[model samples]
Target chain A: MPLPIEIVLFIFLLTTAVVIARLEDLFAAAMLTGIFSLLSAGLFTIMDAVDVAFTEAAVGAGVATVFILCTLSLTAKREYQQPTRILPFIVVGITGAALIYGTLDMPAYGDPDAVPHGHLSAKFIEIEEKAFLSQDKHAAEPAQHGSGEKAVGLPNIVTSILASYRGYDTFGETAVIFTATIGVMLLLRTRRREKKVSPPNRDQMETTS
Target chain B: MQWLGLWHYWAVIILMMIGLYIVIARDNLVKKVMGLSIFQVSVIMFYVSTGKVEGGTAPIIPEGGHDLVYSNPLPHVLMLTAIVVGISTTALALALIVRIQEAYGTVEDDELNAIDGAAL
Candidate 1:
C-alpha cells in the first residue's frame, strides 16, 4: 500500500514537536513552534478540515508565536537547571497506563459497527427527514426531541454547543475572563501605588542614616 | 508492521506528545509556549485528518458529474470556526504575555517565582 496520508502527517507533526523540544535557544524554539503550527494547519487542510487549519495557521502559528517572542524580550533566554522529581513522573505513568487500558474498551475510530451508530445516531439519521419537514412547518413542539440539526445551520457545532446548548457555560467562561482582567488591573494598580509609597520610606531611611 | 495502517495517526499522536513534553520539561518560558503551540497544532492535524476519505474528491458540488464522491464537508466547516477561536485565543494569550513581562520584569518562571516569594 502507498504511504498512508495519516502517517505522513504524523511524521511531520512528530518532527516539528521534536525540533521544538530539542532546541536550547528560546527564540529559535518559538519560531520553530510557529513553523510546527503552520505545518499542522497544512495537515488539517489535507484532512479536509479547512476552517481548523485556518485557525491553526493564524492563531497557533501567528499570534501565539508573536506573544511568546514579546515575552522572551522581557526575560532571560537561558534555561534554569533543577533536580529531577520522580514522584510526579510515576503518578503520570500510572495514570497514562490506566487511560490507555480504558481506551482499549472503547470503540475503534470510524467503526461503522460501533455502538454509537446503533444508538441515538441511528435514530437521528432515520428521523432527519422528518426533522427537516418539522422545521419547514415551523410546528410548535418540545425542542429537545427536535433534530438538533440547528447546529448544522449554524455551520459550527462547537459554537452552537457553546453559545446555544451550553450558553450558560459560555457565559461563565466569559465571566472568568472578565474576572481575570479585573484581577490583573487591580494588581497592576496596586504596584503603581507601592512604587509611589516606597519613595517616602527610602527618603526617611536615608535621613536616619 | 501489523499496525501500519494506523501509523499516520500514531505519528500525529507521537508528535503531540513530543510537543507536550517540551512544554512541560522546558524551563524557558518562550520554549514552553512554543511547545504548547506545537501541541495545539498536533490536535488540529488530528481533527483535519479525520475528514479524509479513501478516494473522495473535494467536497464542492460538481456541475455535471452525477456520480461524484465528495468527501464529508462537516469537518471542514467545523475547522473554520476552530481557526477563528484559535486566533482569538492566540491574540488573548499574547496580550497576557505582554502584560506578564511588564509586571514580572522577567519571564523566566523560576525567576518570577523567586521574585514573588521575596515579595511575599
Candidate 2:
C-alpha cells in the first residue's frame, strides 16, 4: 500500500537533487536545497521516523535554508562556472559504484530479521513497552516506579533511549552544537580594536598563481 | 535478482553520487556545503531504511501497545539529533564563508586560492 508512495517520494528526491545540481542561481539552489530537505523529511515520515522527520523539516529545511540565504546575501548570487572537470566525475563514479557493489550482500529492505532490528533495538523496544506498562501500573500504586520497574520512562522510545541510554552521546552532540555556536558567534562578531598583528611585508609576497 | 527490494538503495546511491559530484566538481563554497548536506542526509536515509520492519509503525508505544510492532527508534534518535547538530555546524560553515567573502572578494575555490597565492 505505502510502497508506491515511498517510491514516488524517492523519485522526487532524486529529481530535486538533479535540479539542484543543474541550477546556477545560488539563491534558487538554496531554495531547492530546502525543498530537497523537505522531501527527505517526508521520506523519513514514510519510513516511520516521526521525530527524525520533524527535526529534518525544522532544522534541515527551515533553518538551513535561512542560513544559506543569509550567506548568499553576503556573497555572490551566481555560482562561477568552471570548465567541466573529468577527474571529479571519475572519482564520484568510482565511489558510487563501489558503494552500490557493497550493498549487494546486504539484507533486503524492511526484512524484520535484519541485524539492526534483531539486536539492541529489540531490547530497547521491550524496554519502551515496559516503560509504557509502568505508566499504566502507576495509576494503581502510584509509588512503586522509577527505581527498577520503570526504565527510561518515556512513552516515546526514541526520547527514552536518547535521554537515558544514550545520554552521554546526546551530551556530546550538545557540546558540538555549543562549540559550533561559539565558533559562528566569534567569526561573525565585529571587532572594535584595530589590527593586532603587523602586516606581511610586501617584499616577501610573490605572485604564484 | 530482487530488484523490488534493492531498487531503493540504488536510487539513494544515485542521489548520493550527485551530491558527491557537486561537492567535488562545484567551485562554489556554498554549493559544496549544500552537497555535503545532501551526502549526510543520504547516510541517515540508508541507516533508517535498515531499521524498518515489514509491518512496523512509529516507535511511540501507547499504553498496552506491546503487541504492535515498532520500527527501530535508535536510528531515528541518532539522525534526529544529528540533523540539528549538523545544521548548527553548517551554520558555522556559512559564517566562515561570510568571513571568507569579506576578506576576499569571492567564494569560488580557485579564486580564493589565486588570491592566497598572490598575497601574503
Candidate 3:
C-alpha cells in the first residue's frame, strides 16, 4: 500500500535531518538546510496550518539560511576539534524528556473532537458566511455615515489582525528590522584612518628606494 | 508502516534537534552557522507539515465554480512574506561575511579567537 502523505512527509523530514547532521561542509549544509525548509513548507501546505508555514518558510528557510551562509563565509568551514562536552548533552536530554512527558496529555493530531475544533473554531466556520453577509449589508448602508471601504476591504482576518488590530506589533517588527540594518552598518563600517591605510601604502614606500 | 502517522512529526523533531546540535557543538563558526540553517529549515518543515489536510488539494479557486477540494491558501500567502524576509536576511549576512573575510586573514574560528586574544 502507498504510504500516507503524513508518513511520506515524515520520511522527507527525517532524511533531511539525517543529511544535515552528517554534512561536514558549511556551504553544503546551508544549502541542504534550505532544501529542508522548502520541504517543511510543502509539508505545512499538506497540514492546513498556512500561517505557521508562511512564517517558517520566510524566516526559517529564507532569512535564517542566508544569515547562516553569510556567517559561514566570514568564518572557517571545518571544525578544528571534536566537542568533548557530555554534561550539556545530558542536561538537554533530560529537559527534552521532561517536555515530551508534558505533551503526553495533549490531544492527538487532527482529532475532530479536540477542544479547538469543538469550541471557537467550529463556531467561527459556521458563522463566517453569516458574518460576511452582515458586514456586506452594513457596508451597503454606510458610505456617508462611516468609512465603509475601510471596514471590509481586507479579506483575510489574519491580515487585518496583523495590519490593523495588532498594527503596533507590526510597527515594532519593522523597528526591529530597522535596528538590525543600522546595527549591521555600524558594525561593518570602517573608520577613516583604517580606510586610508591601503595595502599598497607600505609596499610602495619599500619599492621606491 | 503502523507507526507512519505520528512518525513524521517525530522525524522532523529529530532533524531539528540534530541541526541544533551541530549549531551548538561545532566549534567552526561556519559549521555553527550551517547548523543554524539546518535548525531553521527543520522548523519550517515542521510548520508546513502541520498545515496539511488528509485529502486536500491546492487552495486555488477553480474556474466556473466546479466543486473541488483545495488546500488552504493562507500558508502560501504567509510563505511569500517569509521568502522576502529570507532574501533580505541572506543579502545582509553575505555582506557581513564579505567584510569579515576582508578584516581577518583566515576564517577559522581558532585563528580568529587567537587574533582576538592577542589583541586583548
CAPRI-style docking class of model 1 based on DockQ: acceptable
Clashing pairs in 2: none
Best by lDDT: 2
Ranking by DockQ: 2, 3, 1
- lDDT at residue A8 of model 3 (Cα atoms): 77
The DockQ-derived docking category for candidate 2 is: medium
DockQ of each: 0.27, 0.73, 0.28
Q: Give the top-scoring candidate (TM-score).
A: 2
lDDT of 3 at A132: 44
**lDDT of predicted model 3:** 0.55
Interface RMSD in Å per candidate, to 1 decimal?
A: 5.6, 1.3, 5.1
- Per residue, candidate 3 scores C-alpha lDDT tens digits across A6-110 of 577667767876766666666777777777777776666556645555666666677677677667656656445555677646654664566445435544443
Cα lDDT tens digits, model 2, B57-120, are 9999877765898999988888877786889879999999999998898999999999999996
Off by over 4 Å in 2: A142-150, A192-209
Residue B44 lDDT in candidate 2: 82
- Each candidate: what lDDT? 0.56, 0.84, 0.55
